[model samples]
Target: MTDSGALQKFLDGVVVDAAVFSLRPDYRAVLLPVDGLVPGPSDEASEALLQAAEASAREALAGRTVEDLPHVVAWREAYKSFGAKPQRTRNSLEALLRRAEAGLPRVNRLTDLYNAVSVLHQVPLGGEDLTGYVGAPRLVRATGAESFDTVAGGVPVVEHPDAGEVIWCDDAGVTCRRWNWRQGRRTHLTDDTTTALFIFDALEPMSDEALQTAADDLAAHLLRLGPDVRIVRRLIANDMTHPEGT
Candidate 1:
């Protein structure tokens, strides 16, 4: 299928808005829509990619700690600005880089691949199962009223973000909390996911070119899942007055 055909069908009635970027002018996000993925256990090619990415991450972390990394440090500050404790709720990139020092978990093909890319590029990346989304996915400062679905103890519980906290949400609830620290269980990726939405988040210290390269690398790795996979991407920046298609 063509790019437009795939994106139009997958994104039908699904609007993704990055409203937080308007206020936090230093923020940048790149959205990647992918279709026709055969998600399952990692194949030989994907395994090799993950291995190489882990090795690269280890080498990159040799002399410096995660806190010393420019991108990680920027994200920590961003979290603090919004009332999040970076020491407790570390950003996704920091978490992944730390895990890579020991070993990255092999969750599934898509998750493993994105986790690797996040570590390799030193950017916060998230992959959500698009099919599980209720409506639009938005990044906005919460009003302490938006619902967030997560697990409490052994049971599923519904929670809400603190007022003015930066979060990613849909009509159903928050998808990610504190920018990239925690992802809700509602729209998480799984082995059954066929279509996916990947978010690449960057801050001031991180350049646009770096974000683009990370997205490109992710798309390339995702294509390894299947032969007929199609991908489309859009870059949302602080300079844009309104989000695309809004």
Candidate 2:
């Protein structure tokens, strides 16, 4: 199937188990499936964006700490709800904030851009290579049977999420474990990815307007990546709201 077709199909099958909502009714995600993008190593443009994000992070935390940030506080509680230790396994947003004091990793153009955007909006965002996914994406409390590919001691290894730990997965296995703590190697974005999926995770204190603003900022940056870039977005929550493109 084409990129758009596959994304639409993925959206059709997207499921956030009711149990997950029961854990945190305020939890929501902004799923953006985009195609027709060029990809390359991190360049000066991405570097500039990253620098701006670093400054933004510093400004946001000038007189405060990551744990004191409202969004980070909300996410920490959310992680605890699903049996994960927040301090040990910080959410993506907290992880980025902590790293911003030094410098963010310059992975590649796409990854760097999204990381910058995530930091800019103070939201947890994840980008994946759509081609690496199997079946449709799902958010559920893991049963400990799904495989999670990763590197350990510089060697590749497979692990599983703890039973009842919230995870993002597909038919093949887990794509992300502990909600947003870590992304699997299988679906991680790389320089070769032309079509990608970006997920923005939000919780209480992050208004819908704020989430939409973040999504809009991300889409704007994405459209500048390539001439033919196309994006479709949807907000998945109890109401299952969809943006215009979706």
Candidate 3:
């Protein structure tokens, strides 16, 4: 299938809506819609990519720390503005970079690919199962009333984000807390996930060209999952209008 065909399949089951508000004027986001995935354990080729990405990350980190990286510094400040302790709850990009400095764990094919890309590009990237989505996926300030499904003490539990927190949610509840800190269990990607939404969150110092490059890389890697895979992409910015008819 073509990229548009895969994107249409992903959009068939649910409406995906997203926006960025109350963020620094330089904040940017790229949303990639993909469908016809065959999620499963990491194959040898995928593992090789992950390994190469880790090596690249390690080499990049050799001269400086994660905090010194412009992208990570912007994210840390963004988290601080939202009342999140960056040291305690590191953003996904920071966490992944730190792990890469040591070694990256092989999760699954989908997870490994995204994680590798995130570290390599120095951007926060996430994949969520669209089939599990309740309604349109949105990025808005949390009201502290949306329920977030998570695991606590090895058991499932529900939690809520602080009022005015930056979050990604659907009609059901928070899909990700603190922009990219923690992902809810409800919409997490799994081996059965056929359609998925990938989020690439960016700030200043991360240019539009960089964002597009990351999205393109992800789309290409996703195609490795199956010949029938499809993908669609959109860029969300403070100055841009809603992505429609384009």
Candidate 4:
């Protein structure tokens, strides 16, 4: 388990810049720093969760397209506000939903579990290796100078976000680009990850009550991943931070 003080300090450093809030005043993010996870390759349990999520996605899209969902529409507008073409640069939620129609990726135990939660709850969720982070996480509009490590044409390369692009970063450049569109390679979760940071992005049409329900479900499932799983969460909105339990 992480030291309580250290974990609190890390959470304290999480912030959403005023520029980002100015772009979308309705934005809210739930940051969860969890520890004591039991990580491994995906097994029967995780596969079952993925199957259930696929069914949920199919049910949601039964008579409608992915773009017809209100939450997805809000996210698309959010992307366009920052000069991104939503169709070309799809947000994580939309991408997941589109793929979930066929099936969700089974990366590993840790990632598979969160992906399932994301699809089941209809939220854009991101998970990172807590230990890989050089500093705490923050959301800001990029200046087009930060280095984002990613693969291009099957080769490792560094890329930079366009100026005014919304991004999640720390002292070590960008961690995620275009809001929740894509996560950098630096802090991605792995099969051995035991400590992780999860980002849940929300906007209008998704109430705080609903977001809390999703978080509650994810936490309940995570508790079964390990005997000593420990979790600390906070909600950041309107430039203010509230500890999970007050």
Runs in model 4 lying further than 4 Å from the true structure: 239-246
lDDT of each: 0.82, 0.90, 0.82, 0.90
Clash totals for all candidate models: 0, 0, 1, 0
**Candidate 3 regions off by >4 Å?**
1-20, 240-246
The 10 consecutive residues of candidate 3 with the worst lDDT sum are 12-21
Off by over 4 Å in 1: 1-3, 6-19, 240-246
Candidate 1 local lDDT, 138-170, one digit each (tens): 788899999888998989999989998998888
lDDT of 2 by residue, 133-235 (tens): 8888999999999899998899999998999999999999999999888999999998899989999999989998999999999899999998888788878
> What is the TM-score (0 to 1) of candidate 4?
0.96
Candidate 2, TM-score vs. the true structure?
0.95
Q: Which ten residues in a row have the lowest lDDT in candidate 1?
A: 10-19
lDDT of candidate 3 over 29-116, digit per residue (tens): 8888788898898789778888888998888888788899999999999988878889999999999988886688887889889988
**Pairs of residues clashing in candidate 2:** none
> All candidates' TM-scores?
0.90, 0.95, 0.90, 0.96
Predict model 1's lDDT versus the native: 0.82
Give the lowest summed-lDDT range of ten residues in model 4: 237-246
Q: Please report the TM-score between candidate 3 and the true structure.
A: 0.90
Better of 1 and 2 by TM-score: 2
